[model samples]
Target: MRRRISMLAGVAALGLTLAACGGGGETPAEDSNAQDASGNVGVFTWWADGSEKAGLDALVKVFGTDYPDVTFDNLAVAGGAGSQAKSVLAAQLKAGNPPDSFQAHAGAELQDYIDADQLEDLSSFYTDNDLTAQFPADLVDRLTVDGKIYSVPSNIHRANVVWANVEVLKKAGIDPEKPAEDLEGWFADMDKIKATGTIPLAVAGSWTQVQLFENILLASLGAEGYNGLWDGSTDWKGAEVTDAIKAYEKALSYTNTDRDSLSDWAPATQLVQDGAAAYNVMGDWAEAKFAQDGDKPGVDYVYFPTPGTEGVFDFLADSFTLPKGAPNPAGAKAWLTTIGSAEGQAAFNKVKGSIPANTTAKTDDFSEYQKSAIADFGQDTIVSSLAHGAAVPVAWLNDLSTAVSKFGGDKDIDTLQSSLGDIGEKFAK
Candidate 1:
């Protein structure tokens, strides 16, 4: 992959420092040495339901314990992958009605906000709290652009995991533990699954499809080529992309017809866990869903890299940022300080089924899947996720998602590939 945002090497050096699951801590609002705060602090996020909501609640508990005086306003608009929340935030920011703090993925996704002066630099915030040393060095670098940091990351999520229902796979004559070597091999297994009258792949919404599309690109193009899609080294209209989407289209054939009814990704994940679906290709956040559904790993469920994506980590981080004209900057800082704290990360990421961004957080209570994810993240070849805003700005991703969504409806590969090419060209210019 390109060296521009090479983060795994740095993350690996510090990644294992993160520790166990969420155990509520503090005096009702204290995340270990968080400066006291008061008044209402509106923190915007997409984690309004399911295990994702649980993660936010865990963090909020820590915040409440540390800053008892502050009333935390949960300004969450439920949506898969912030599909709805981002647009709301954009509108609010433009109208000069910004939340005190908001969640954003920590890469090119922040570009538009920074360019438009919609965000406040958190560089001094980092220095004051000693957060620079707490997070992986390369991760810190990824957060910085023009020598300023605009957000404090909570956790790292891997986008290319395939969660499987062991029983469902077993019924389909598929080995839950042994992942297929590539897309073709995976599709062969999916065919068997389809014959079993099970959803071979449970996908929901455009975001999920875009996520699957990127994983297909990774499997087809490798890390360097996938990275090139974002960095402009690879042509989106090239033969490589055409061949890749063929696999993507093939993968889609095994999905459930009721995908449109499944608005959030959790229900789709639930299908796999409930044995109604054989597989669900989702980010590690699905781990939280598995746990939430009381599915045990290796027994009730299993996971691997999306076919052909083994040894590659499709990465995205969830971070909180201070808006330029936040209503309560001090309260927002308190929220951020708590978010960056080891205890807060421990609590939040534990329920979130993601590894903490803070390297120094405790790790003794993590689930088996989480432990495996931390290990994988430490050693895997990390690449930015196009669906989750690590690789492309939100606008560009929306363009890609629109094209992918349309493809899902129309099944027109030529139009899909051509539209994507135009999007790439437009973004590149």
Candidate 2:
């Protein structure tokens, strides 16, 4: 996904003044005429290229059918982890001139906007549109705060996938169609891949890499130890978490790749695409990269959950949120509605490599990997990805990332566990 969301104001003081005044007020206000008024939807996002962009573009295109006059102004900001875009968005909202719509995660992450009263009460709109009928209860529950719907999800994404280069696996004397079921088997396969002169694992220190680390942690520790770290119900200093940390350190030893020097998600993905690396830990959306490279899933590449992890499902969802005070309230709402509509969700996820948030949407557009993802959703053991920064509180997530990175960089398991214990205490407070 491209990081293309940025602030659209302040290029010129006079220009901003005129734009605000043009709204027929001294300061910009919501388009009350929306629904009853012609509303423009100003969307802020980070999807600047590739299949991710295609998904959002499809949503915008369909939105035009129902709202022609509602001009869709997209502010594309480019920054990994959306850090730069988020900083700009914070400034705009703080200055009382937020975008009509912006993207937000479908978990506790939205609490920041809700705390600032910078989000609208979407309860009525959700009811009016009957969105509950299509969205899963868990998804709707995640986006709801108190009693109001603060956002509308476009799709669900699964973290914790092991993407392999089928050709590379064959060269390594491993079956591309069948993956190892446990950590020992996984390591053995990696050794075979390494013996073949291919990078056994394509990894980096980037946020996405950290996400992959967390997925592995969950697989190594199981859901009990995994959820305990963030839910305030389990101890991070336990044998399970320690074992997970040790496994991560051992895995990092195998990350000897040209990608070790880079910090982007695409390089690791490209390694798999180019068949330079035997495996990569990424989300199912990686299927898009494989498809883009003309590689066929199950033939050129295959997906499996991190080896040996039970309850082998990780859940996360993405959505667009309308800022509380928007210049294009109507357009934003229309876009949100379009996002939830079965057609829009299907169209977006088909290209983006994610499952539609609307459960009613067809999965035909998804590739073989995504088909398995949808099947996984049916299992009762699915859990959220704390490493991808979902489900857990932001503070705990950052802390966990720091601790995990240290562990990956050769920190002792004992020290890593101690750090986790300290972070867990802070989260509890």
Q: Which candidate has the top score in TM-score? A: 1
Q: 194 in model 2: Cα distance from truth in Å?
A: 1.2
Per-model root-mean-square deviation over C-alphas? 6.7, 6.0
Worst 10 residues of 1 by lDDT: 9-18
lDDT for each candidate structure: 0.80, 0.68
Off by over 4 Å in 1: 1-36
lDDT over C-alpha atoms for residue 317 of model 1: 83
Task: Estimate candidate 2's alpha-carbon lDDT, on a 0 to 1 scale.
Answer: 0.68
Model 2 misplaced regions, further than 4 Å: 1-39, 80-83, 257-260, 408-410
Sum up the clashes in candidate 1. Answer: 12
RMSD of 1: 6.7
